[model samples]
Target: MKYRFALNNDIPNLVRLINNAYRNNIDKSWTNETQYVSGSRITQDQLFEELNKPGFLLMVIEGPDTRSKQLIACIGITFYETYAEIGTFCIDPSFQQAGIGKTLLGRAEQFLQIYNSNIKAINMYVLNVREELIQYYERRGYKKTGLIEDYPLDANLGMPLLDLNLIEMQKTLI
Candidate 1:
């Protein structure tokens, strides 16, 4: 219900939330990547480096009420010269399917429009094997750009269980 920019102290929780959403098999959701990839979704060191990058914005959605203040969702946006890239998006498994991800995504786009009016579009990369995720974005107005890039296996985001590539998806904001 509450959204704000992520602070340095949020890295550990972000790491856990992302890993559980993407890699953990116990509470599998449509977002889980464990079927196609292995290892942690992201590491603290990687997230720390990303947080310090210029033009990067990491936003978190908190649970309603001041007492609990739990992190329910998070998304990362990186502004580029002509557009922005969305990544590191996840919602707590308990929070999935309740429109939280959709609301957070809209908030991220709105933030970009306000903070960087020149940005013409928003882009994100989804693993090619994630058909359901691709459809989710498509339904949200993103179109496949027909661009495929090799997955960054060296980035330590995860190790592929099957051959994997990233496909670009874009939504024009202007």
Candidate 2:
């Protein structure tokens, strides 16, 4: 597996991968969101805008599966002066449970460390309803920061089957 920042040409496939892992209900058992959401997690336009943001690193993980070396996973991180926030993290459902998500996260942390030695923490938000996902992050050393945010209706994330909120999680890297 190879990890690198996504290029301009990677947006479409990235959109597909994220939606398949987050919103699509077609045999995607890795995420709990599928049971609650029924639309694409992100659109190409949104992803393009995210990629162009300052201090935002959209990373893609490519595999040697196909002849073209297709991307199988991805994540987005926005760096602040002394910390960073991670989002848009997903692995293709077909590639889930194979440790790809964990590996991508590990590599991303390492890369961020190299890029910003002053970074003291890595933060992210998990759907409060997704207990399993929260546990996963907790097992990886993230602790809740006592912050909760309402799911945005205009974010185009999806149509929620139930009320949802995002809870903050952070891991101190320093």
Which of the numbered candidates is closest to the native, going by highest TM-score? Answer: 1
lDDT of 2 by residue, 1-174 (tens): 777889878988888888877877457647637777777788999999989988998989897665676888888999999999999998887778899889888988988899889899999998898888899999999999999999887888888889889999999986
For every model in order, what is the number of clashing pairs?
A: 0, 0
**Native-structure RMSD, model 2:** 1.4
lDDT of each: 0.89, 0.86
**Tens digit of lDDT per residue, candidate 1, span 92-124?**
887789998999999998889999889999999
User: Could you tell me the TM-score of candidate 2?
Assistant: 0.94
